[model samples]
Structures are given as structure tokens and as C-alpha cells.
Target: MARAVVRAVSASPTAQAGGQVEEDPAHRTAAGLLASHPWHTTPLGVPGGWDPALRATIELIMGSPVAMSLAYGDAYTLIYNDAFATILGGKHPAAFGRPAADVFEEAWATPGVGDVVDRVYRTGEPFREAETAVALVRSPAGEPEQAVFTRGCSVVRDSQGRTIGVLTVATETTEATSRLQSLGELTGALAGAVTLDDVARVALRYGLSAFDVDHMTFGVDDASGWRVVRRVRGELLDEADERLPPLWRRLPLDSPSPLAKAAGSGTAAFTEDGTPLREVAADRHDQRQRAMAAIPLSTHSLRGALTFGRRHAHLWLPAERAQLTAAADLIGQAAERARRFETQHGTAQLLQRSMLPEHLPNLDRFRVAARYDPGIDGSAAGGDFYDAFVLPEGRLAIVLGDVAGHDMHAAALMGQVRAALRALALANPDPVVVLDGLDKLVGMLGTGTRSHELFVTVAYGLLDQRDGGLTIASAGHPAPLIRHASAEGQLATVGYLDVPTGTPLGLGGAHRAMTTALSPGDTILLFSDGVIERRRRELDDGLAALAKSVAEAVSGDPRNLCALATSAVAGATEDDVAVLAVEYASTPSRSATMNVPPEPTMPGRVRQWMKVQLSAWDVPEAVIGAAVLCTSELTTNALLHAGTAARVHIDLTPERLLVSVQDSGTRGTVTRAHTDTLSSRGRGLGLIEELSDAWGTDPTVRGSTVWFEILLSEDRENP
Candidate 1:
């Protein structure tokens, strides 16, 4: 066992109460404090009469660099080096010569410090503590922060070999402990990353914060070659540059490149100046950015590099190097995990798509458009699905649903559920009956297979084109949206078709059908929860956003509406998104015109109006193509030149289709044509004449008229 510090020094005990004693000049300040105190009234009277061993021990410890504190002569009087005064904080000068117990009256309750001191003094035993947390007034503001210390205690003795007091040596460990915690957090963040990209993102983010470095880079080998992500002062670089994956033009790492050297040898590389990497520098402006260090990310199957740098020159401390090493190891492990997940998910996704419908029914009465987008992890599969098909009696059936998983089981379950729903719908056209059967099937599957995640949310809709009747049912799914618009340029309206939301599949609950009649150009949209579920926003907000996007699109054509609705939001799709849109077009339209407002939103509103008019008329899709385009051109011209509201008139007959744009402008050609993509007033009316069978301009009663006509095709088509 360790014993208290004892320095050999010759000192004879002073017999007189007021006799002189030897002292070191360099340490006189501390010695003076001892001398200035009223020792005459204390148990260990005047310094002159103090024991020789105590005097010699005090003299030796007072001038030492280490933080040491000791009590002596049964009074357990306190004495310490200048370094130890900081540890005492507010309890220093007054505690100098008092008994340790009296000075540390409250602290005596705490273990490790006071108890260890007392035990050592009483039993002549030595003790050491690896780490002890003590609350101390460590700042000038008299506030306390947790301070950790490694302490060693031993009994102090005098010339007679009898115990005097306890000596304690303490070294602060707060900084080291904090570093350890930081490393733990980084490891956890890396452990949670789900993809190679996620791993790189977390690694760079943590490295930037933890190391406080000016530059960082993460490189990995993947299907996209040896790709690297670099950031300067935490700003990601080479994002807009197409040659980003490699980050440089060079095929292989150069001989002198810090990254190359470190990765090649599986060790760290350090450099003072960044000139060695100037050849592969992102640009000339950052050629001299200081180089700090580079470490390799290595595993048996994968190898890459993580490099860090600062703007100013600095050397890596041992502790800092060790921290970087640990961080690199975690990133490598995360990369490996990401690889496995991506591979497994890719296979699952292929299976998922194979199970979904390859095509929607080509119904002549209404247009159908469906789309399925897997979540942010593209390689991963989800349970979301969308399907549209014609029933035996000619009604169109649409289904959108989500299963509860990201694995193969969920995808397979989604396929089975979709097929089962279709089968039941063919037998019975009632939306309520079809969904009830699906609910029972799911409940049985969960019980039979003992699957933890067999829950499903589904919405089913059946539409009869004859009466524009649409019936919808839900099993805890988001309500479908119905968008209605007028061909006369009225504002399009979109709202949820409030269907009774019952318990999710596997949980038996009452399912009810809501019947609603669609207007001439109404579209019903069915979508999975992924379309409305978001990480940063509430489900209500996402629903509102979807409704707003649908309202703006308002294209009676299902395809256009589907495209716009899916493109409405930002960010990666974190869940599977499935959408099915079916527009009602039972009534045949003959003639219609939509008012063109003179505003920035005019272009989009005009498109929706024309789409609504054509769908209401059940106009052939092939015939409506360039006609819509050229009509938009004429309206924009009238709005630009006449500077007044314009009318887009669509007149269809058995033999031909005619469209005219009229506005209150005196000129035959209200506006000059432009060569811009948005305003296809295309060079002149000459381009219009070439596209249509014939075109001409005439003076109307109020202003002017630009008209075009095309021979209708023999075969009718649907979009």
C-alpha cells in the first residue's frame, strides 16, 4: 500500500513558544500565512513549537506543483500547496489552519473525500479513488459546476511513527470525462444511420462540431465509384458540380495526397500545409487551406477515408488523435450496416413493384392515373399500394392502402391485401362490403401467422359513370379528396369526402359507405397515408397542403392532377406514397369558354379550365393536345395586348373542332407573338396556322378574334 509523501529534511524541534524557524524564501507567501495566524490560541501552538516532522512535511508540500492537502498534529490542521487553493475555491484562506472536519463540516457528509480522509487518519490505511464528482464554487461568480477528481489518500505521521492526519492528492478529471461523453453521443448517432448517405451526413456533422475543424471530408466505395463528401467550415461542397461523387478529376488518389497516404497505409497522415493536395483541391481559392490530419475507414469488405483540417496550423494532440480514431471506427461500422440494409431493401423493392398492377384499365368514360413512390430510402420497400380496375358491371373500382412495415413481409402482405380487395369487389360492387371482407382477412392473417405488424389502413372507392355516383369506404385511412371545377373559369374547389374512418385492419370495427354524386368534371383522389404523413409537420398540415396543391392543379384530367398532387411537397418521401385519381366525365360537352384573368396565376388557372371543359365534353385526348397549347397562346396574347379579360371558346362538331380567343382589342392581332416557352404566342400566328388545319384573325364586335380549327380524328382516345 502507498504511504503519505515524506521528504527527508533535517529539522530540530523548536522548544520555545516564540522561537525562530527556517523557511524557504520562494514559498514565504504561504509560510507567512501560517506564521500570521494566531497559532498561540490553537491546539498546535505557534509554528515555532510545532513538531519537527510536521514542520518538515509542511515545508516540502507547500512548494510542490501537484495539488496536495494535508492536516497535522491531532488538531488535524489544514495545510496545502498554492495549486490546491483553487480546488478549495471559496473555502481557502479561512480553512488554512483549522481542523479539516470543522472547515469541511457540510462536505464531511460526502463519501470518498471526507470519509476517505478520516478512515486513513484513523487506521493508518491508504486509499485511492479513480473518480469522484464534487460540487465546488469553481468560478469567480460563486457559482458551482460539477468537478471530477482522481484522489489518493494516506495517513501522515510524525517522528514517533504515530499517525497525525490524512494527506489527499487530487487531479481534476472533468475535461476527460466530457470528452468520453461526446464520443458516446457520436457513436450513437452513427449507429442510427440507415444508408451510406446518412452515415456520411452524421459523420461530417459530428466531426464538425466535436473537432471544431475548418474542413472535413467523408469518402466511401459504393456503386457510384469512390465517392466523397467534403465540407469547408461545415458547408457541403461540390453539390452543384456534376462530377461530385469523385469530388476530383483524378482517377486514383495521388501519391502525396494526405487522404491517399492515410487510406493506403491504414494509418493517419498529418501535414502542415495543404499544398500536397493542391492538385486535387476543389478550386484555386482554397489551395492553401491548412491541412490537419487524415484517417482511414477500414473494414474487411469496405475501405475509405475520413479527413479533417483547420484553417490555421496546428498539431494533433494525443487525446485529439485518439478521438478521431474512435469516430472513424464508428463511421466504418455504420457504413457496413448501411450496405447490408440497402442490399436487402433493394431486393424487397423489386418484389414490391412486381406485385403491383402494371397498368390501369383504359376506360373510355373517365381517365385514371395512379402512381407509387417508395419512401426516402429508395432501396427499401414499403406497404403502400394503389390499384384501379373496371368491375363486371362497368363501374371503376379504386383502392389505396398501406401495410405497417419496411421489409419484404410488408410488401408481400400489401400485394395479397390488394388482390383480395379486387377479388371481393368484382364479386360485390359495394365499397363497404369489399372493405369489410379485407378487414376480416387481415385479422385472420395476424392471428394465424402471429405477425407483430399486420395492421393496415385502406380506402376503397367505386364510381358509376352513368350517374356520376361515387361511393367510398375507409378502414382508418385518410379521407379521399374530391375536386370540382366549372368550365366557365370559376375557382376550383377541393375538399375531403368525409367517410367514416373505422379501426385499422386486424381490429374489427363498423365500416360505413358515404355516397356522393360528382359534378360534370369532378375528380376523386385516393391516396395512402404516406401522402400526408411527414416528419416535421402534423398530419393535418400535410392534408391541408395536399388539398391546396390539388385545388391549384384542378385539371379535370386525372393524369395532370396526379402529377401535380404528388409534386406538391418538398423533402425526401419518408414513407411510401400511393395515389389514384379518377375524374368523372359522363356528360358530353359541346361548347364552352373560360375567362382568362390578367394575373400571374392566369396561366395555371387557364390550363385547369380547358382540362375541365374537355373532360366534361368527353373530348378525345389525342384531339385535345396541341389545341389546348395554341389556345393558351392566344389568351396570353389577348391578356398582354388587349390588357383585358379574354375568352377561350371551344366549339366542337361531328366533323371538326374549333377554338377561338376574343378580347376587347381593336387590332386584328391583339398581341405580338413571343418565342418564350411559357408564352407560346410562338413567333407569330404563322406557327399556329402550321399546327392547325387553318387559322385566321377577324374583327369582333368588341375587339378582335383569333380562331383555329382542326379535323377531328376518326378514332377517339382517352388520357
Candidate 2:
């Protein structure tokens, strides 16, 4: 039998042969290998001749408390150790000389063991898990229970510095694991709680009961009134607790309260000698003076206070203050979220009413209906509006328009334009006439009044039911819809050709056109641009929708038709919208035909119409000369080329005069040409091209209409 002896980890030891040895970091590497790698019988790697003394020392190392083994190739053989036989479950000691994989195959299957071993093999880094679970073999009829382990690792090396195996040492950690579980449960109970009141109760019950505290309370500060959220009292609290006032009501947001200052600065104010209570007494009204600490409960802008007090004037402990300070931060986070929620709710209400009308008008023919629907997803208001009133001629002048933006500024501009349009229209009954007048007045309305170009698009109409007709005009506005009483009534677009109507109000245009037609029924549809402007679709799609809705609702009264149009547009998208629908009692038929008489030469008729248009446009005498010359030349072009029936329609507005010729011919493009030697016949077309500011052709089902415009002095003054 080979005798075994144990030596201490230092250079010398005093262990008898065949007994246990104390394990420590210095020799843990060699001890772990001999215990697990049980079957090796190679010569010791020490140099032979000079280390006989060391070889004898290595032999004596075998008598340690740990199991002893050696491995050669794949075979593990137990060398000699009393501890080696104890770990074999019920197997006899004869089982010692076997493969290491076969002996501990079940142990290798334990969770987390394989991963640790693989890290040591691949990266050569010793990995340790603290308080990890492990399984150990027992006697017969036994079940495995979890056991905690602290593990260490080291790489085993042969003489050439090549890794041969890995060594591991593990110790039980069951007692430490149980204490950690209890601590986690207590912390979780405090973190998951809500409400300052509940938080105070939890703090008092757990913090005071465990730490033996006298009092605990939570403090909060915000825009609303500030107050002490809670004050704890118990059986001994009456005697132990300092007689403290309701601190919450006394400390307001504006006051210099200790909790408010600590919360605002996000700094913990702690003093064992009652410095916090003394500061509060000096700055505010506090009767009691005892040991107090303000644990700052602050996150972002929300502040929370955890104030402590003792019935006897004893100083607070540092450890206790530190614990409360951490809890204060958690409380502050919850308070911040609640404060933000309350602020957002208030902001929503304020923005909702910002765009609504300050007051409604009271006019005889104006039965105005207005509706404002703010966006559900945080948008306040967009620009849409309607206005109406009885003009001097008893005709109700109705205007509907949209400013181009969708903010408070857009809505404010919308209101200003709407009120201006009504005032101008009331002073002048012509829709075209009123708009031209407004164009001149825009410059006088201040720079802030006109913040953007192309600020608005409007459709204005003057309804003179006393005369049984409506004069309609537009400035880049959607067309007014007309529905009749017939069963198969198709929605008709009533006005004639519309030009880019004076460049959308704000861009400095000289004129707007006023076209008139007899109202065919009791209903007329007037709407803002939103009725025919939709996203993800062409402009034609909105036009088609308006026509379809009007045709569907034709048989219904004006109120229903208006409702149908609004519903149709509103259902399609989220956008600002305004509409005005006026209905009058049905009237009997008027005289159908106008009496015709023989007239003079076409030049005379054209000249007379030009003067009438200039008067309506309110053009000064200075610009009338150019307008007269342009109108004459256009009429001559129509009479000469098409041999067509010609109708001259001249519209006079306050800003400019427009003269158009409707001819029975196809649209012909005009060319800029050199003037010929003053011949009367051909010079007319050249002169018209030169004198007119701008002109174009509108091709319709009947034929083509060539039109020209002259900028009047009125536009120059106002625009």
C-alpha cells in the first residue's frame, strides 16, 4: 500500500498521513484535479534527477481531505484517498478505475454546468457562478434536491504549456440564497405599490417597523395646491412621534419649503441633528423641532418628499437616511407621470376653443349655421369659415372660403378675411364687384393681416331673390352646386368660364369676374375649397363626389341637400370644412324671352358694352382708354375669322374689367406677331394682343370663348 501524507498550503505542514487537508486558493488547482480526473498513473512531470525531494513531496500531497485520482489517456484510476470512495453513491470502490465521462454523465446534464465547462475549454477563462444550483449523488431510493454552489476554475497544464484538463472547486451557498430571496420580496412589495398615501403606509409599516422609526410621510409639489400626502401614527407613535402639523397644506409651491427646495434641486437633505426641521422653522411656521431628514423624491420635474421625525430629539442614522433617499426617487417618477397627464388634458381644452367664432352675426336674410370639429389626434383647428348678410339691395351676399394653413394663425386670418368679405359685400352687392374692392383694401389691412401669399380661396355669391337671380363670383373657389326638383335631376355647374380669378386674393391681381344667372330652384350650394380637395386623389375625384352627392339629394329640400353634401365630404377625410345653403319660397315663371330689335354695326354694339363693363369694374377714366381699345380688337377677331354667331359678355368688377367673345368655332392658339403697316382690317387683332394685359381661350361644348382683361386703377391702388 502507498502511504499518503498531507502538507499545509505554505512551504510546510503538520497533517498526519491518511487524513483531511484544508483547501485554500494557493493549492485549490491541484486538489480539484485529483478529485475529479480519477484514473492517471503517468510519471510526475517534474525534472527527474534534481527534484527527487519534490517528487517525495508530491507523494505526500495525496493524503488531503479531497478525493485523489489520476488520468492517463481516457482511463481514470483512483490513486489513494478516504474521500474518493464517499462520492460513489452506493457503488463499490471497485468502480473507481473508469472513464470520467461515464462516472459523472448525470452530473454533466445538470443545468449551467456544461456551459461553464465549455467556456473554460474554449476561451481558457475560469468562469464562476455565485449561488448557482447543483445536483449531488446520494444513497439508494434517493431523489435529488437543489443545492447552492460557489465554483472556481483553473486550466491544467503539462510540461510543454499545453492544456491537458480543467480543475474545478465548489462550495455550498444555501444559507446566503435564502436571505437574498427575502430581501428581494421586501423590495418588490414597495416598488409595485401606487399612490402617495399607499406608499406612505408601506413605508411606515415596513421601513419604520423593521428599522424602528418614529414617523414617516411623503410630500409632493406641483402647479396645484401642495400638501403633506401622509403622516404615519401607531400605538407608540403618539408618544414616539413628534407632534407635527399637516405639513402639506402649509408648504405651497411658491413658498420656501424644505421639501420643495429639495425636490426642485433633486438633492437629498439629511442631518442627524434635525437641521431640516430647524430650516423649516426659520423660513416657515413650524412649532415642533425634532430630528428630521428630507429624502428627495425627484425625477425630471416631479418632486417627492420623505420626511422623518422622532418624538425624542434623537439624531437620524446615516444608513436609515440612505435607504429612504432611494425610495424617494421611485416615488418622484410616479408623481411626474401623473402631473404630465393632468397638464396635457388642460392643454387640449384650451386649444379646442381657440378657433371658434367669438360671436355670431344677426342679419335678416342670414340664417347662418356653423359647426367646428377639432381633430381627435391632437390637432386644434384648421381654416374654414362662412359669412352672410343682407346687402343694400336686399340681396343676401354669402361668402365661403378657406385659408391655406391649419393652425391658430390660419384660423385667425380666416376670421379676418371672412369678416372683411362680409363688410365689403354688404357695401356692394356684386360678388365680382365686392371681391375687386377687397383686393384694393388688402394692402390697407397691415402686414400681419397678410402674412402669406395666396392666403385664401373664396366663392362669393349675391342672391337677389327679389329679382329672382343670383350673381356668382369666385377667386380660385370651388363651383357652386345646383340641384333641381326633377326626379333625374343632374347637378349643373351654372357659371361660365372662370379664369384664374385674380391670382388667389393675395398675389396681387387686377380683377375678378362677376357672372349672373337666374336661380332655377329653392336651393343653392355654396362651399369652401375643402369640399372638393382631398388627399390621395386627383382634384377631379372631389368634383365627381360633389356632383354625385348633389344628384342624389336633389329631391330633398335645401336643408337636406346641405346635410348630404357635408356628410359626403366629411366622411371621406379629416379636414376643415364650411358650407352655406339658402332656400327661398318657389316663384312663378318669369317672361321667357327678351324682345329683339335691329341694331347698328357690330363696332357700335361692342363699344357700348365696353363702357358698361368699365363702369361696373369701377375702372378710373385713365385706364378706360386701354380697356375700350382691347375690347374692340377682340370683337373684330371674332367677326373676321369664324364668320360665327358672336356674343360679347363684358364683366366689370372693382379691380378690373373683363371682355369675352363667345364664337361658334374651335379654339385657335394666338401667335405673338409683328405689327403690319397700319391697315384697318388686320391691325385690330395685333392691337388687341398688344393692349390687353392677359387673354386666353376657353373651349366649351358650344364652341370657343376668347377673353381679355385690363388692369384698372382700382387694382393698382388696392393691390
Cα TM-score per model:
0.46, 0.33
Q: Residue by residue across 146-172, what tens digits does model 2's lDDT show? A: 555654543333322334444443335
Q: How many backbone clashes does candidate 1 have?
A: 1
Full-model lDDT, candidate 1: 0.66
Residue 93 error for model 2, in Å? 55
Candidate with top TM-score is 1
Give me the runs in candidate 2 sitting further than 4 Å from their true place.
1-378, 440-454, 487-500, 518-520, 554-556, 569-574, 587-719
* Whole-model lDDT values for every prediction: 0.66, 0.48
Deviation in angstroms for 493 in model 1?
4.7
